[model samples]
Target: MFQKVEYSGTKAQQYETLLFQVKALTDGEPNLIANLANASSLLNQFLNDINWVGFYLKDGDKDELVLGPFHGLPACVRIPFHKGVCGKAANTKTTQRIANVHEFPGHIACDAASNSEIVIPLISNGELIGVLDIDSPKFERFDDEDQHFLEKLVNILENTIN
Candidate 1:
């Protein structure tokens, strides 16, 4: 049984709380997939306004991102390096936060409802491994606070997933 975890605070505060929950959930877990699943679930539950919250795992050859754990509508299963937002983050090994999806170059409209997005690359052993992708229907939904919190959350994910 999946119990809904309620967050009580401003959007940023709620996300922070969720991040901590995810960190705690993944801490000391030896299995990478279980950690990723919990991380994805936390993101999907806490980020109420988001349309997508998930991960794209590095492929067998380490050249591309293949769909992994996620909680939302269906997403792209495979993304080539530098192809779209998720790909760009993986290719560059950096985070990309776009206020408006329409303004981004080469944006892939997996769900036309997504107006904003944030993609954080996951690195392990100094090599690009995957990306945590979040999308929202509201423009400019994610701010600097969100960036920081997500980065911290990704750090936890990096340590656990690897």
Candidate 2:
């Protein structure tokens, strides 16, 4: 059973709490899909000003990202590796935090309402797993703090999913 987070204190402290909660929710679960689902749900519950949160898994032997579990409106099903923000994150194996999606060239507008975006590459055992993608409607909605915490979140997922 999952309990809603009563986040108090600084954003970093809140995220630290969130990370612990995620660990609790996903601990001892060996199923990847189940873990990802619950992690997305947890993020949706904890985050603010976000319209979408989900994963784009790397299709085996393919150069594209396929939509996995997500929380939000329907999203684009497939994003090529060289295409948008999600693609860039997957390609570079790094985090991409965009303040304004419109300003990002070749940005795939899965949802027009999303103005800002963050994507963290999920890697395990030197293999690319997928990406954790979050979107918000407000410009500059995410900052360094968000990136740091989300990276921690992704690290938790990567450690547990396998």
Candidate 3:
């Protein structure tokens, strides 16, 4: 049974609690789409100052990403490698935390309201699985702490999917 938790502590502490919840939510779930859906829901409800949260899975037949579960406005369905923040993350297999989307080169605006964004690549067993993308209306919404904890959360997702 799942119950809502009202976390009370430092930001790091809250993230720790979130990580535990993710493990619980995904521990026995073998379906990748289902797990990603739950993960997106958890992040949507947990984070603030964010307009979007979602996942982009690597297309099995090509070098591009396809949209997955998300909690927010409709997003771009496909992104080629190195095209946007999500693309860059997937192509480079690294996390991209952008303070301002307007300043980013080759930025793709699925939503005009978003000012900041973060993308974390999900690699499993040395293979690119996808990426976790979050967008915020506020500038510099994601920092080092967010990057660190979100990556931890992604690890949980990766473990279940792969």
State the number of backbone clashes in model 1: 0
Q: lDDT values of the candidates?
A: 0.87, 0.92, 0.93
- In candidate 1, position 141 carries an lDDT of 91
Better of 1 and 3 by TM-score: 3
**Model 1 Cα lDDT, one tens digit per residue, 1-162:** 658877797867887788778877887897878888888887887776898888899997867899999987898888988688898898889899999999998888899999999999989999877889999999999899899999989898888754
| Candidate 3 residue lDDT tens string, 1-162 | 566668789999999988888899899899999999999998998899999999999999688999999999988999998699999999899999999999999999999999999999998898999999999999999999999999999988888864
TM-score for all models, in order of appearance = 0.92, 0.96, 0.96
Off by over 4 Å in 3: 1-4
Worst 10 residues of 2 by lDDT: 1-10
**How are the candidates ranked when ordered by lDDT, highest leading?**
3, 2, 1
Badly placed stretches (over 4 Å) of model 1 are 10-12
